[model samples]
Target: MERNPWSLGWIVLMCLFVTNRARELKVEQVGPDNEAVYNHTLATTLVEYASAVYISDMTELFSWTCSRCDGLTEGFEIIELIFDVEHCLQAYVGVATNLNAIVIAFRGTQEHSIQNWIQDLYWKQLDINYPGMPDAMVHHGFYSAYHNTTIRPCVLNGIKRAQEIYGDLNIMVTGHSMGGAMASFCGLDLTVNHEAKSVQVVTFGQPRIGNTVFASYYSQLVPNTIRVTNDHDIVPHLPPYYTLFPQKTYHHFPREVWLHNVGLGSLIYPIEKICDGSGEDPSCSRSVTGNSIADHLIYYGVKLGGETWGSCKIVMDQRLAKFGSKDLGGNFVFSKNPASLLQAGSETGSISI
Candidate 1:
């Protein structure tokens, strides 16, 4: 039987159409509706608390005695120091008496110096739905980091404890790098499970957490989130988003505040940009290739992964552990040496994969 050329072409065209629809990218972009206004002081302040979470000794962290937290955590009383020895994850749950808010700060990747969590954006699998968004699939590593270990339960217990002590005070969640990803999960968890009233999340050098569905879901559920990415900070651009491969791609939530420097010559101006609410704004940090690890370490002149050579040192004064309460309040302060990314800048690992 002779086959008509026109009939053959029609079959091929139909195959292409079916394949395209099968892999129809589940991404949706809405006009920029940025409601989360960037706060300079608050951003600067939260990064300090985020940095302080890198402390090894529980006593130092619980006492609010870390230098990074000095002057900033003055009114904050630590309620719980969450650490999962197995997963190597650490976080702190505390109450800021002065601010009348509860704080949750998660520790990022622990490296002595020159921390590089986003050398490459690679993922083999992606299957996880956040609290309220079933269609939204998130990054596997981030999902495992936040959900697969005891860290989640510990954090929950800490939040529950804080609420019991402080009443339904506003919750503030902050972290840097990988910790920021975990903070995103915690914020959503609090909203869905704990029935948290007001949740504010601020993160530094945070990477993309989920796909478009997850991003949109997160933006709607946790509306007051500020993701701060510094100039050339490579972490936020990963796990890379591929327009053609939406199912395996990772995406960020809305309201990214990018910090970069604009200069003509001797005089320079530092600029902090509020990205479009669409979550992937080309005019924002995405404008650059995102290839700097040094930018990931410091946000507003503060080193995020500080002195982790001996991080989360389990030092216990048994007496204090047993008799310890706010009733026996005291602080043992330690000094910190921070590298500035603006005025006198320091550089770290600078390779992009």
Candidate 2:
């Protein structure tokens, strides 16, 4: 076999690129005092607000507010949009005055479309640059699809309206599952592109968004991010940390507030841990069981009258059926076919994962 000099040089360049990028991965552990920063009352309230927007009719949400938290009815605004071909995406943006802060919450996955789940697997460079920040990359499909819809403009409009009424209050972006992933992106966008200050993102069962580079950039850019995960929620383990493809690498953000014994009533005491900021922290969800969809469904608690109960599971079930079976676990089934796995590893030039 004849070896081409040009091909050898190209291989060397690619190896150097991977090496340099690998050096950039760093996870910083936070202090236990950081747990004090997370307010259960506020998180529960925001989760309720985020869950409410999942209703098909905004009036139902309004009625619930009138019945439960009458104060929310005064300064609450809801914006919903369906984008992408076949209108597969159903995203809602809720701007409300809560906890003395302006909350902008995004609704999570409502309908189960193979197309939408595939979007979760699409990873690429965000290609947008921020001042004093590295070039951030993200799930290309989610980022593009979100901007394609009216969600962006609607959120901007909502923020503007909130400021007009609330006068420079703190802004919080939150959601659950897929909505949480979007919330992370939206929060970063608000701070980087729109110059919105004091933006805090608190998400539930959010999957890994981007590779190490994107995660690092996001952690640095949006330092006040809090990602909440239930004991065995499977959504947070998605896009698999160990994969044959490099571009497909997915990582979670830092400042994780993990809820163990989620449905165990008063016995459930949420543990707040500062993740290594690296997406593949062994101490986090990735190390635990990766197939607990039921855990993802219930955040705070499951029962109707249970303390810290949030209707996310009930609301999500009403939106889509076959909740437990629609698993992303198949994405990692390559081990069953060693020949195909070997081929993929060879093509990618590096199979470190």
Candidate 3:
């Protein structure tokens, strides 16, 4: 039988199409069943508390001890403050006795120094040993600042003290912006290196920490990490995923809990998406428009009403009012209205990612 050239071509095309479709249908299943599972009520409460802690750390006028501190949820009391002069990192370890959880909240960029921003710019390599796991390399600056400074020791000591007093409570590590990055590092370190059990990390508006390998390693070690990104947040897109320089390649973790706005006013809900756990998901924040800072500031604000709203903004507004607009070493500038702080900054502040 003579095969018709056109018929043969059609057959070949059909085969190719079928193969491609099968590949597409082969979904890349990543992580466990409960990997990216998020509890709306729990996440809202935790993030709100974390944001409040950040605001408290940023503004000295509103002490952490203040009962009416904005976003200061009841039950969680600050036990210790961790500070690193060289790294310019500050965090507080708080205890929620009723919940049996210890919250380690990191302070985001503040008015004192641009060290956090400077750390973001350092994308070099610094390898570390991970026992019973793959050898991992992280952001050089982040690792150095985290390792060299007393931050880690202070945190570990705080956790130890808490464990001694409370007896094996859950450790919840959290932060916003630069603090988020540090939170990620601490979460991974504590889980993999220190063998700290039941460590849950929830970061807000955090930037990418390391390369693909580091992300995968961190994801496997700390599966419960939930990165919360607001709509069009500029910080999450930082340190460029696809840079001309080879060493500059960075990736995010697998789980992302995105807070999407329903309408104009404070109505928002979280939608959880699980990537391949490889950190290179184009569908995540890496592909979004990198122009909005409003999203970062309003993480736990009233407009997005829930347990988390209005507290962070209240503290921020108070701080800004107390200290007028100056180069607070952070990116965004403060205005009369805390919400306006997000809208006031030049988009150039965000490095091209």
Candidate 4:
């Protein structure tokens, strides 16, 4: 076969361009302990759930948790959207139609009770607030694969799918933990591509992705995305969540993560130097309490179902399954009670930011 040199060169350049543009890890840093400003800063990470919590808000965003509604087919409504860009994995998706907007939900890790497996992996090898924590976590085999890589494609595919359905409608991307990260990436892409007039992101217990530069770029590129995190959710404090594409990073862990493990220590432990300092910085010290991961894990139970840890996991799993199921809008049928999920917050689901 004869090959043209010019064409080959062009192909190679295109390949390089696409590869570079694709979601890959980059690192950067921002300012010091500035929680007020830091709450809004953007960051990314591979191991931690940092990416999950980063999100933006919108004017039309609304929520109406309902056991039943008239327009909705089901008594409860939890819509998710999944896409397979290259037909990689048969992605699952569901969309809930609210008053005037749409809630873009993303799926996450499956349910498991393998603390021992996690412990055997050597808790010390992983980053934890205390030395024995990694060990303890491993003993419980409570590990998660909700990393940056797992979610990037899911989000990319969703953006394309959402634009296709409600191209002109406003979007509010939301998720908890890993799902939150996917939502963040998806919302950012929507803004960049001009798919919607506005994009609002609301997440809980999300970790970081990319790095400081990525966060800055993300914030500059899409200012409307607002990330909401609990005072301290452990899952949101993983190490990879702390460093990415290089930018200033923030850690949201409760004091217990620190108090419980003297040897383990937290990734943000260093911030105490400034956050805990006297005068105006005391607030920074207080902000560093709690564990984002724990908060994330427990949030499902508090917001979705159950009152116990195991029940929380079950509720979260069911909710994620709700999002991951391909049959919701396709094969599945809904009842009126579930219709409330569609009508909950915000009527138009449109934000022009």
Off-target runs (Cα >4 Å) in candidate 2 are 1-36, 62-98, 113-135, 243-248, 262-276, 302-353
RMSD of 4: 20.3
Error of 2 at 272 (Å): 4.9
By descending lDDT, how would the candidates be arranged? 1, 3, 2, 4
Model 2 global lDDT (CA atoms, 0 to 1): 0.55
Task: Please tell me which predicted candidate would have the highest lDDT against the true structure.
Answer: 1
Best by TM-score: 1
User: Cα RMSD (Å) per model?
Assistant: 15.9, 20.7, 13.7, 20.3
What C-alpha lDDT do the candidate models reach, one value each?
0.71, 0.55, 0.58, 0.34
Name the weakest run of 10 consecutive residues (lDDT summed) in model 2.
330-339
Ranking by TM-score: 1, 3, 2, 4
Q: What is the lDDT of residue 200 in candidate 4?
A: 55
Model 1 spans with C-alpha error above 4 angstroms:
1-34, 111-116, 123-125, 246-248, 309-313, 318-353
Q: Write the per-residue lDDT of candidate 2 for residues 305-335, one digit (tens) a residue.
A: 1122232222221211211122232111000
Report lDDT (Cα) of residue 14, candidate 4: 62
Clash count per candidate: 2, 2, 5, 103
Give TM per candidate: 0.77, 0.63, 0.65, 0.42
Candidate achieving higher TM-score, 1 or 3: 1
Residues 173-265, candidate 1, lDDT per residue (tens digit)?
999888999999899888877778788888998888788888888888888888999999888888787878765578788888888876433
Question: For residues 1-353, could you state the per-residue lDDT of candidate 3 as single tens digits?
Answer: 88787676566556644643343211112235535445444566667655565433333322344433435356455555544434445666767765568888776766333334534454534445333445445566555555666667767877787777778888888878777888888888888788987888878888777766677778777887778787787777776566564343676776776655332134232434434444555666655786675676677452211133222222232333332332333222211211122223332222210
